[model samples]
Target: MIPATSSTPPLAELRGIGKTYGTGEHAVDALVGADLAIYPGEDMIIEGPSGSGKTTLISILGLLLRATTGSIRIGDREVGQLGERDLPALRAKTFGFVFQGFNLFPALTALENVALAIRMKDGKAKDPEGQARALLERVGLGPRAHHLPADMSGGQKQRVAIARALGGDPPILVGDEPTAALDTKTALSVMELLRGLASEHGRAVVVVTHDPRLERFADRVVRVEDGRIESNLPRLAQAS
Candidate 1:
């Protein structure tokens, strides 16, 4: 796969990673010996059929789940073994998350939603409203700041979600099917915004998706199957 460009260590590193669920006969291997280095300045895409462990890998990388085997290094910290209590704080400081479903608070306005995310990330926001408005404007949602989630279109809501995810300015941005709910044109626009998070903002990005449209924006394409990495190679050329 295309490696990170920086001379320093990777943004996130995984080695000999494996995960299993349950025990004995009921146990199922969900990931196997997955080695990867996600770096800033690159957009990485993980594509595979259902049950390929794509979600599991992202979970481990984002510190939402710990691997049963192997090590995960973020900066100088070996966080693979950190306890659940410690992980939440680290995850809040290190990762920004977006999902297929726009997970915005129903009762909160667009501005309030993003501001809440910012507050959660740092435990304090000097001016949450101002920071939230700026983020909304960045994602093309400034005019919709006062609107509630129900008042916006699917695309608009996702944009608000994106703005919220950026609230922390976390080092790594992880997306699980960020574009799955939108139309072709809207999906492209959302992907464009996601791509900018890597290339423009220099945050490492990893996305798990089935959409081929995302292939163009990716610096590396990884395919997984039956819980193993089938291919971990860079694309010869990206689509237009």
Candidate 2:
């Protein structure tokens, strides 16, 4: 894994993180003793096989789920110290999410979809439609702005999803299996866009993926297995 160029403190930090589901003997540990630091403007990728707890780690980092044990620090504030009511607000302001399914509404045009997210993120957005158009343009989807997701290709749909996620300019952009559905070429294109989010926009980008081919775009790569992060991970190479 490559180290970040910045000498600044971590934007988000996790220590001794553990997670469990259910209770009693039925409990299953999804993650254990995971220590991670997300630096600003870094593109980090989390990789693991099926049931390796990679997704769980991303969830905890994105504040989508609570850790059963460990300290989660976002900036100077501890996650545990924040009230339940504050979580949604904090998550909205701190992270933008992209998922494998694209998550675009079939009924809405690409511009409408992005505009909706902008309004949802900041109800007082000065000009949501104009900002939405600019976002679509940024993702190279300006021509498809009026088209519904059903009329778009998989890559186009994902780009629209990315545009929507870019709303509010969240500091951290989290992606879960974002390229699992794309062909190799399209996947690389999307990964490049994600990497640009970190390098060009100064936002931290964290993605959970099973593809080693995507590692070249990452500044840091983490491997997890059996609920624990491997200490000495092999260097990423071209994988079949």
Report every candidate's CA lDDT. Answer: 0.87, 0.88
lDDT per residue as tens, model 1, 2-76 = 454447578889999999999999999999999988877778999999999999999999988878999999877
lDDT (10s digit) by residue, model 2, range 1-240: 234344687779999999999999999999989999887788888988999998899899999999999999998889999999999888998899999999887899999999999999899988999999998998899999999999998999999999999999888899999999999999999999999878755689999999989988887778899999884232353231
Which one wins on lDDT?
Answer: 2
How large an RMSD does model 1 have?
Answer: 2.2
Which TM-score value belongs to model 2? Answer: 0.93
Model 2 lDDT on a 0 to 1 scale: 0.88
Locate the minimum summed-lDDT window of 10 residues in model 1. 1-10
Clashing pairs in 1: none
Taking every candidate in turn, the Cα RMSD to the unseen true structure, in Å, is 2.2, 2.7
TM-score of each: 0.93, 0.93
